[model samples]
Target: MRTHGWRGQPPSDADEARARILTATRTRLSEAGTTSTSEVAELIGVTRQTVYRYFPTTGDLLNAAAADAVIGLEAQLIKHVVEHLARTGGDAADAAVEIVAYVYEHLRDDPALNRLMAPGRISSTVAGLTTPSAIALGRDWLAHFPVDWEAVGLVGEAQAEFVEHLLRTLQSFVVDPGEPARSGAELRAYLQRWLAPALRR
Candidate 1:
């Protein structure tokens, strides 16, 4: 195999290379506001091609690096959703809107989560959010809801599909966010009008 100035000796195997790329990516994200493929490559003494070989794209690299941060964001989101459910008697659709609105209203206050909501390359960002791990994490977040998903007709595949839908909704809010992003009462009302119907069906 060939190498591209990756320290004294290049990674001995593909696994090490991928790990190094992830490490480099996390480091780059910390030092710079964004994680660029070329920056990760240079930081780790490898060529951009090497980084791409492991990560496929900058979005993939960024998503990989931010996976841990995702969990933290989920924790806060889950807490807020659960609390909302407790206060409001846990309607499934309303809980869904709560998750979306909570992030919209508060994502900026938390630096880590604020950064995560910034959106990325459409393909990779969607791919990243829909990965098995991400999906499972979504389910985990939902599982904490005080409502009975089964009683609401969201069991088995229905529940899993709901998780995916929620992810897409979150993506849209953070990405395009309409001409002006909706939050607080306006956002909640908008979600109740449009998003809640989908959940009820």
Candidate 2:
């Protein structure tokens, strides 16, 4: 028989509570990195023990915070792409370019996110953000993308892989600014050149 491993499914109530607490904690951390447990508990309308029940340690809270931020970020990207596509005659390739440009323009100035994912104390966030929860967020985001993946010569899995790689590559740029510098427009151009061929499939 196969072992369950240590990955037992959480009860639904506990899972919902954990998700709520993590959501609050992420907002606190993104807005203010050195958040207190008391503050987060208060924000979530829960007692400290309730918070502890979900995340037993400050490190755990921080880990959840990172994952939460990634979810939020991906949601925003998906929203933008959806809106853009609707307004622009439903062109997926155009939406893709806009999405990449949006990331290039906004990612650098996002302070809380920068500290959370940068090569500093919170690089652990990267691992958390790349987890299944975060990956699902990305998949959901791209699923609504206005592109015809199959017509573009990419199957569903390959399309998701392409968007995932693009996001991760852009994340690296956000985390490591000194690696190279370019204007937002220039970076957008670069991504278009690199991604366009694969997108065309």
Candidate 3:
């Protein structure tokens, strides 16, 4: 919260400006379940119009911030996957199931992520996930998974399709997640039962 605006200095470039806005948006989400372009503008000592220039819509702002939060989550998932396999002696499908389950949990539990869909933003959140940037992010994340996607006949374009499929599934869970919402173990089992068999070619 610099009063002088961006620590009393303008962003070095457009990239820096966008980065600052995203950082501000994420901070606002951490502090409050929701944030607005004005709020981010105020935080960064910029105009809402400036923020809007970079993120034309609220969805764009929230999604960019959430994506930033997700970058650090990859390391957490890496560890969680290793431990889950060690404990459950799971296979590739199982690992994939755990990954999905873990992500659902992360989305459910992480304030920054969960809050992106705050109140009136549900439609925007859904819209955000479908954006090309969001799809690319999901695809890149899955591409780094340790699971043997080949065994599931998910090589080449099929792999890309599967990644999109997985992203959509996660999007469904995020949007609805059912009436009572399943537990992590229950989620894992659910994915294992349905998603696993589908993957086995």
Q: Per-prediction TM-score, please?
A: 0.60, 0.63, 0.64
Residue-level lDDT tens digits of model 1 in 1-201: 457688877888888887778777666665665668888788888888877777788877776666645555677878788888788776889998988788556544443344555644444654566677777877877787787888888888888888888777776775566766554888899889988987687
Rank the candidate models, highest TM-score first. Answer: 3, 2, 1
Clashing pairs in 1: none
For all predictions, the C-alpha RMSD in Å is 6.5, 8.1, 4.8
Which lDDT tens digits does candidate 3 get at residues 66-165? 7777776777887888787778777667766777788778777776677556778767877676677776766666655566667768677776676666
Judge candidate 2 against the unseen true structure and give its global Cα lDDT, from 0 to 1.
0.64
Badly placed stretches (over 4 Å) of model 3 are 1-67
| Candidate number achieving the greatest lDDT relative to the actual structure | 3
lDDT of 2 by residue, 127-182 (tens): 55456666566566666776766777556667667667766765666555544687
Q: Judged by lDDT relative to the true structure, which candidate is superior, 1 or 3?
A: 3
The clash count of every prediction, one per candidate, is 0, 0, 0
Model 2 weakest 10-residue run by lDDT: 1-10
